[model samples]
Target: MTQAQTLDHTSDQSIEHRIGTAVNQNAAHTREGLLERLFGWFFKGLVYAQIWEDPVADMNALQITEQDDLVCIASGGCNVMSYLMAQPASITAVDLSPAHVALNKLKVAAPRYLDQNAFYDLFGHANKDSNIRALDQHVLPHLDQITRAYWNKATWRGQRKQMFARGLYRHGLLGQFLKFAHALCWAGGVKFDKLLTAQSLDDQNAFFDQEIAPLYDSRFVRFLANRRASLFGLGIPPAQYDKLAADTGGDIIAVLRERTRKLFCDFPIHDNYFAWQAANRGYKSDGTGPVPPYLEAQNFETLRACVDRVEVLNQSVTEMLAAQPEGSKSVYVLLDAQDWMNDDQLNDLWHQITRTARPGARVLFRTGGLTDILPGRVEGAILNHWRYDAEASTRATAEDRSAIYGAVHMYRYEGA
Candidate 1:
């Protein structure tokens, strides 16, 4: 290839190109492809203020040990930070979104300089003026130049400062999406705060059946729900949206209703920080309620000590894994990213995963559909190195407090 061809080829493999390729699976002129591009655009900026996946269930599946090396997709960095509590040897977090990379870096660095209470005020309550202050004084200096530049970008700085002062989880695409959904429910005479007040599962069930279920049944809401673009706020791409629709046999409304029901009724509100975000758009202000393990008071010291062990990569997980030595990392947390991949991408990812995995390595991921997505997608020759833990995956799926995903799966690398 000539120099000009090489330059053009390099441009096609840029992070922007990867995101485009991952999301735009359909024909460019098609409706599905249009929504895919829209999701890609939205995903370019801040998509998640807090990751929706349950780090607790993830840790349970990983059973991370001191000897283990982990690589995870950094959504909001909660799981990456929380994994420190497991005493992993090191963690490498990679993401295509620059916003997510910045957020993850901030979360990893803040615990080092701030006291537990101050840390809680910033990330836990996530709505104090002190958070921006903490970012400037404590976390900012520790963050890498790229992360610092991301937060300092004049266009994004104000919105991010406002997010920190108001509530970290109350901003972002996912946050704003939930805010809109909440308002839609309120307009329909449903209140999430009322559901939070329920003390028992039966009460939660009653609240959902009476108040929440009807909103899903609304013609206007159902119409909105049917469109893939409506879910862009949830950080779900068109590819995953197809699986979600398929999960309910094309009844997207039913899928929405059932997922929402699981989120509200499957667990108690006080113990579920995911529920807190769904209801209140932030963690408890009083500090007695559940929060991410990294935000817990007892884990503060652990986070501070282990924060140095984290490596934040602003790129695709497949690219990051490809740079690692053979049999390097033992734990992989894909966090539903495979749902975004095409057949070639999936095969490429598994090849790297199987290449980099150590003995008894565990790869944990979630899906938007009930079925195993890897089958017939990832090449069987490549898959020969791994075995699916069906029973553990089912239990993990049930144990996941986030309650949004259809399934959580585990693949163990038992060797070829």
Candidate 2:
């Protein structure tokens, strides 16, 4: 290649790396920026083994049609894969985290390459002796080189994909954070077995009040919750952390306790895979509990047939949207990533969302606090093009089974 061509390629790579860095390192010399960097460092690798956002809530809000095209942040890839059951025209999944992008590719590729039982064993059962063979024989060869390298690369324990043979859901940064939370509970002279294993809603609530809720009031727990780094495992950056604390009158522990209560008592244990995952590390081994749509036995054929319509990318959402033609995308799933963006970043994102969005396109996102974030932050010109649906947003938020988020927002583009 010529010298100019090589320089141009190198510069483009540099720009790619810088895309999301500013969101985390905006206040680099300040204490807030330091916490951001710490969270960024911890978040550089695999964070969520499963996306926390509820795909059910997403599909409901999006109201996707076969003519619709989607762009979403592929955290655990669950949302993208599950959306296939709806049979959208295509999905363009992007993530700033390389680890998450790799995970997304592997997830969709496995369904295309592996049979029902093998795919279930690998992801549904999530810890099986046969997964290694399944990966080697069926899934690995079909994945992109980056995805193959990611799963096959050596980690301290072994190759990354071997996690499926062990407890795949119990190894990511979120998983380790959960492990730490459990340990903290043990140290605090309380255990969650009573709360998590309870058979009835009344029993769960009683256990939470009698044993779990009081644990948050302790000085040790309060001190840790106050630290911005403590909730990093939940992928809550320092910026979101501040917002959550502010919303709760500086009582992060109180807010956490409330969310935890909702996760346990709001839904029955047999029905909520999220609660099972939070308390038990993996889904119910007996296959009686619920799971993501893509992980369901009934949806297996649908996924196998439609997995090719999905594409995974390790790029910022704004950057990806900027490259798309105007009015091309119909649905946008921002997740809760906007909780980390500053005013400028939020403006940039809305600009692209408006540019790439069709007149009737829908945008859905979750927030750490109970408010639509775009109102005052995003510039008027860009934000004005979109119309917020308060009624639909409220109904969808209530329907959301995943109790982690404080609010869910939906908006429709009205065009210029």
Which has the greatest TM-score?
1
> Which model scores highest in lDDT?
1
> On residues 314-340, what C-alpha lDDT tens digit does candidate 2 reach at each position?
778988999999889999999998988
Cα RMSD for predicted model 2: 3.0
Candidate 2 minimal-lDDT segment of 10 residues: 14-23
Measured on C-alpha atoms, candidate 1 has an lDDT of 0.86
Error of 2 at 375 (Å): 1.0
lDDT (Cα, 0-100) at 32 in candidate 1: 83
Off by over 4 Å in 1: 1-13, 156-159
Estimate the TM-score for candidate 1. 0.95
What would the per-residue lDDT of candidate 1 be over residues 234-311, giving only the tens digit for each residue? Answer: 988988888999977898888888888899999987788898888888877788888989888988898899888999
